[model samples]
Target chain A: MPERRPKIIGFCCEKHGLDCVTLAARSERQYDASVRLIRVPCTGRVDGMHILQALEDGADVVFVLGCLEKNCYYDTGSIEGRKRVEYVKGMLAETGIEPERVEMFNASSSMAWKFHDIVSSMKDVAERLGPIRPKGGGSE
Target chain B: MIVAERKPLDEIAKMIAPYEKVAVIGCRSCVAICLAGGEKEVNMLVSAMRLKNRKDGRKQSLDGFVLERQCEKEWVKEVEEKILDSDIVLSMSCSLGTQTIGDMYPHKIIVPGLNTAIFGVPEEQGVWSEKCLGCGDCIIDTTGGICPIARCAKSMLNGPCGGSSDGHCEVNTDIECAWYAIHERLKLQNRLELMEYVRPPKNWSTSHSGGRRIIVKEDAKLTPHQKRGREVLE
Candidate 1:
């Protein structure tokens, strides 16, 4: 039996979110969770280029979770993130990959439930999408 | 400030794929501030390029070095010999810096590792808005320090077209109406009266429309190569 593990990468807005993300994946062993979550000061820091970089670096699906729109202390960071996500999704569509591979969602303080739901759904989506053709066979 | 973006690592790797001795250079000016061709990006790119090439079974020679300003020949004088020694160069600067190297060393095979964008300003963090189109004109004075050429969706010089509504451009709901912003700025300064002054149709000679630009001054004459060649050989 081939152990099919969906590779999902997430951009978390905080260390707290990162901790929860890792914990949830560890606790729920149902999916072969090869999730690589990168924590940034804010989701706004994730540029369209960076999202594409993650996909090119080998992520079946990419998600960016940011502070609610207008809620970021950095002023319009969530808006920037939203804009970048849309731009990256458009680029994916142009590049033959479905734009749905990349997603943008809003989050704040104690939305661990929302975070869990997103990751769970992403794992489900990636399982359906299957493994992408890894770049140059350069395994991460 | 100038606009620039980093080149794709795989494409860049492919450029230097044939050469074993590669000299990668970074410009510390425009591209640096843009975080595209800066020192930090140079280091990261070299590492990534190396890994990518190695995976393809080709051993590449790459050494990363950043000049204080790659657009000028003086700042890069110290590395002239090293640059010449390399089989090829990977210019990680904007078009100007990359071309400057090509101008200085005509024989060296210089490959551009970045895409030059435009004359723009940073809007906030990680966002850049183009302000100058490098058009052959300067009517900003009448626009109350706002650029109608670069910002206006239609690049209208005189006034807002009928399309603008609520200070927002019809081109996109999200984008601010540049002329509306200009009008508000002029109104605040009590200089709204300047709008009536019709400047002449701009002279194309003063801008990119004319030809290659040249700035000659008495002080910075005869580059190091010229001066050294004249003084040391006798």
Candidate 2:
């Protein structure tokens, strides 16, 4: 069998999340191409369904990137996002999926180094977990 | 309103495993307000199920629909065709909605997605405490508007039982004793005399102990035409 690249999906809060990523790009900081970033109005807007949908779409891991807790552009938006991520983690665990497969991170727009580290950390975890085995009796 | 929580995902997945096509239905009334069964919840459940199918290599299709109110016959009628079209239905609404769907379509398999918790009000953003038992006999007036039937651990009509101390129920120190709350409330209102009145045993027949119950209002009875959907409002 050959090795397969783990698919990683990131739900980024536009206010700070996307800005930080742009900063990382300008600084010429390299990150894995396997990571896909989706920008939303605020991290709070990233519903639990969106996270689950991303996973169902074959992404090995999903992460929610948001503004610092007390500094969210939408007030408690990032905090709400954190709660949502935590909720999905519990659900995944109940379904026999690794809770670590989903994660939430906080950072400001100027923190390009932090954003890079976040992506690297998520990618590493996804690689360690490997592909999810289909439930029931079947071979994928 | 009814408050409920979604059942574990694995349990729901197993229930719908036998079906090839499933409809995930949600209610916009009580369950929706509680964030249990609603349009958002329906979508998430469907998405999670699809992911499970993908990982398991199972060939199943899941769809979502949110009714205005699943317990009402009229609102439920709107999705009659869509539900009938699916191989099975996974209801995200409370048990009432699940049963209502089951009653309307006796032949189809109805899967309950939520565990109906209680009839209560939201004390905070995500916390809900049971406040009503639907005992069919409401005596809150004499209890200073604090219901002993629902709030009391033992449902003691005249309480603050021997187990109550420091205004907390012995069953759980974290819970405030309903009778204690009643006493304070009544005292503040200068109606402490109401508490001295000896109370008689409650009529259990008004509760679930009496078996399935129904309310009939002669004036609210539907006409034959209305029963046939002749007067269904859009």
Candidate 3:
């Protein structure tokens, strides 16, 4: 059998999360190609459904990257983002999925290393989890 | 307002497994304010169910919509087309909203995504407590506006029950004794004599035991308006 390349999704907030990614790019630091980043205005804008929908669309793992807690440009946006991630994690657990498949992270615009670490951690999780089975015979 | 919590996802998944197309309906009224069955909840449920179906290879198609209020005929009508199109409906509203949708589309299957928790308000950000029992009669005027029927463990009308201790109910230490609260409130207002009035047995006819209850506003009916329309037609 061939290896299953993991599909990962990151809901990145425009303020700090995406800025960190851009900063990493300028520093010649690269992230895994398997991770797809969808930029949003704020982490709080990423609803619980958005995370679940990504999983349904074949993402092996999904994470929300937001500004540091209490440092959100929208005051409570990152906190709201964390709440949404937690809510999705609970739902995933209830549906027999690994709750860890969905996660939340906080970082500052200057912290490219932190963003890279987040990606690497999610990549490791996705590799171990393998491709998410769609509806039929993917039994955990 | 009615408060509810989402039913476990596994239970909801099992409930809708047999359906091919499901319409997940949400309400933007009380349940919305309570954060149970509102637009966000509707979207969450739909996404979760669809993800589950995909993982299980079930091929079930789930769609979602948030109605103004599923309990109203006009609002229910807004989603009539979608409700009719789907094989089943999963309601994220309170029990009344679910029942209203079921009544509107008698031919469709209706499932509730939330369990009606209680009639209460948020004490804080995410904490909710029961407040009203809709006991058909209210004596809050004399009870210093505290509802013993809903808050007291024993629903004692005259005063605190034997179980009340240290301003707490015997049933749970976390629950403050309603009678004690009423007493304190009445004392502050200098209306302690109101407690001396003996209340009559509650009229249960207005409650669930008396069967389906209805309230009609006779004065609010538009009979005169209809009569004027008829005269204009003549």
Candidate 4:
């Protein structure tokens, strides 16, 4: 048997969230290739269904990256995103899954370091949790 | 609109655990507006149940559907095939919607995914406050267009209870005393004199206390001849 690499999914707001990630890449910073990012118009558009579906599809860890709550591009988009993340976490807890498997992070366009930190932290979580076992048997 | 809250995920999970095929149905009317049961909620719940099943090493098939108004027979009829195909139905609507499906198919297993809370209006973006009790009688005309029966702690029709303090209900500080609000509204409308006229004892027979009440609209109902004709057509 070989070591298994964790799979991670991140739902990022196109506004500040994507900007931060893009800037990090431009700065020659490298994050794990296993982390896949899905861009949306705003964090508010990321519903709880998306997060749960990610986990259900076998992603070890999932997260939403949005603009800071106080300075969201759409005023309350980040707040809404945080609320949905919290709701998903509650559902996960109820389902006997680790609530920490899903998380929400805030970022600004200029904060490349924050993007790296978010990815690193989420990657760490995925590594710790390993892959979520599929319905029948083997992990994805 | 009727307001409701989703039942805990564990409870819902346990409800359909014995069934291999389950259908999660949601209503797009009041439950949708309240963010309790709707298309999105049905999908979320299905996904959550799937994940939970996967975690527990259980294999169950779950499908999600939404009805325009689950309380209506026509809307429920549209999904009759889907309801019949499933071993159990998890209704994500108010009790009325749940009962509609149960009534339509007495032999099928129907369970509620939400706890019907109140007849309320959205106070703000995410807040819903109970505003009516469906008492079957309208008395707001004498109470400044505010129903003290629903808002007041004691449902006192005459005036504020002694426990009311500083415009808040004694039952719960968060509740605004309905009588105080009525008084303010009456004063604002320059109808303070209306308060002096004491209300007589309310007739409780018109309310739910009277036991299952029914209103027959004779004009709208089909006559015996029409019923026979419709039966022939069917």
Candidate 5:
């Protein structure tokens, strides 16, 4: 029997980079089409609880896709999101969840080609990791 | 007010393990002011418990709610609706508040999530020490506002043992000798002669050891007109 594919939830910044990966996937032959994407105004708005809720809802992999550092249209949104991601990673480790399951990526709106590469790279990483447990305490 | 600290997460998790539906309760009175049991604590613990449950595949349900004063019967009644739905209640209040919850609802299991410490003031933002051992009698006025029983390493009633040197206690050089504090106050007031009088040992019998102390006065218990009117204010 074939193994079940993981649910990779993507939170993309709506301002300048939300569709970069989508456009890239359409033009590129190597883009991964199995990820779910939710577009928000900016990564800065992503709260710690949001990442926790995603994992609690059974997401095997979560990605915060935002504009490249220093290039975010909303000033520090990308930077803030990256900091939030780091905090969530520490929290996940305490609960026996692998820190790699939660990730943050940066891409420019014009880098549609690079975005495609990032998504494909993300899919490959998720394939190796199994299910993620909630944040407090648990295993496997 | 009382000072308290939350129990370890692992220990608290074990306390609520038997129940599927758990309610994390917090007290906003003493515990809140002391920064121990409050709404933020309730939210954090609830989130942690939910995450733990989800990982275990046990399908647990959890919620959080806080009352203003858990020690009082009236304030505890405010959470009546939430309590009815939970299989167990984990109270993040002082032991008095926890016991009050238990007394109010004998049918449900009320668990304490804090180890209640003695009455104390905020030493800093997050630290509170035992200022008043509840020694039955309060001698703040006589001791220059500091409690010897609490600040002194020996809880010495007379203080600043012979070991106190250069204003520091012998037990620990880092600590300021409580007797030195008293002596300083006495010298400043030109009442150094008061130190010549020997003080008696503390009377612990007037404290919690006597099983709940009470002060009652027939003349001060009520107002004259209210007793005669027999009418209550709604």
Candidate 6:
């Protein structure tokens, strides 16, 4: 059997989070191709439902990348994002799912290395967990 | 407002296990404000349950809905068809809402998704503290707007009991002594004399301790003839 490619989804804030990813690509840094990036106005806009939905939709690992807490473009956007992520993690733990499958990371526009680290870490998680398999197959 | 907390996911899963079609309903009332049951909560719960079912290889159809107020028959009637079509309903509201659905559909199974916690006010963004006991009496006027029966662990009518120390309740150090607060509040209002006035024994008949209570307004209720006319119209 062919080695399975882990599915990873990242919700990135348009401000510093997206900037970090853009700079990483410009610097000729390569990350896992299996990872999909979603751009949002701010990390605060990401709801707990979004993270859970990603897992239900076959993403083995999901993450929220936001601006650094103290310097969020929207003042407390990243802080709010972390709270939601933590809330979802609690729910996942209660439901007997691997809490590590979901995570939150902070980044600045100039931190290309942070973007690479976040992607690499999430990719590692996805590969380790494999796919969240439904009874007969994938999600309905 | 009535505060509630969601039940454990495993318990909720077990309640709907025997049903093929399950409707997870929420209310936009007190439970919503407390972040226990609302539109977002209903969706999040359904998604989580679906994931659980999928992992366990249990095939169940789940749908989510929200009502303006679950305890009101008018809003419940709006989703009548959805209720009748489902094998069971998981109500994510307070007990009043759960009982409303249960009473509306006697034949269908209605399970409570949340434990009605308290009659409280939100102290902050995520904190809800119980402030009312629904004792069916009002005595806060003498106590500086704070109900001792609700806030105090002993519900002592006169003052703090022997358990009070340093303005805190012995039951829990985190809880402030209700009488201590009452004294401070009264002192602030310059009504410290009210503290000296002894209060009489409370009448428990007006409270839940006296069986279920009901209030009837003659003017608001329809007469027999009017009820008949409305019944015919329906």
CA lDDT of every candidate: 0.76, 0.90, 0.87, 0.92, 0.79, 0.92
Query: What residue runs in model 2 are displaced by over 4 Å at the alpha carbon?
Result: A1-6, A129-140, B223-234
Worst 10 residues of 4 chain B by lDDT: B50-59
TM-score of chain B of each: 0.88, 0.95, 0.92, 0.97, 0.86, 0.97
**Residues A1-140 of candidate 3: C-alpha lDDT, one tens digit per residue:** 88667899999999988898889767767877788999999998998878887887789999999999978888899999999899889888887778999999998999998887888999999988776665345553
Sorted on DockQ, highest at the top, how do the candidates line up?
4, 6, 3, 2, 5, 1
True contacts kept of 6: 0.70
TM-score of chain A of each: 0.79, 0.93, 0.91, 0.93, 0.85, 0.93
Which residue pairs show backbone clashes in model 3? A135-B54, A135-B55, A135-B56, A135-B57, A136-B56, A136-B57
- Best candidate, lDDT-wise? 6
Candidate 6 per-residue lDDT over residues A42-127, each given as its tens digit: 99999999999999888889999999999999999999999999999898888778889999999999999998898899898877
Instruction: Please provide, for model 5 over B60-169, each residue's C-alpha lDDT reduced to its tens digit, 9 standing for 90 to 100.
Output: 78888899889998888888878878999999999998899899999989999899987888778667767778777887667667778887889888766788999998
Give the clashing pairs for model 4.
Answer: none
Which candidate model has the greater lDDT, 5 or 6? Answer: 6
Share of true Cα-Cα contacts across chains kept by each model: 0.00, 0.67, 0.79, 0.79, 0.14, 0.70
In model 6, what lDDT does residue B15 have?
89
Best to worst by lDDT, what's the order? 6, 4, 2, 3, 5, 1
Clashing pairs in 6: none
Clashes of 3: 6
Off by over 4 Å in 1: A1-140, B135-137, B218-234
Question: Scored by Cα lDDT, where does model 5 land?
Answer: 0.79
lDDT of 4 by residue, B65-171 (tens): 99999999989999999999999999999999999999999999999999999999999998999889989888999999999889987889888889989999889
Order candidates by TM-score, high to low: 4, 6, 2, 3, 5, 1
Name the candidate, 3 or 4, with the larger DockQ value: 4
lDDT of 1 by residue, B1-234 (tens): 888987665577667888999999998898889988888777656654543443354567778899999888887776798789899989889888888888988999999989998899998978998889877567787898888888988888776889899988999878898888988998999998876777666676887778887768967798888899978964
List each candidate's DockQ score.
0.08, 0.57, 0.59, 0.66, 0.17, 0.63
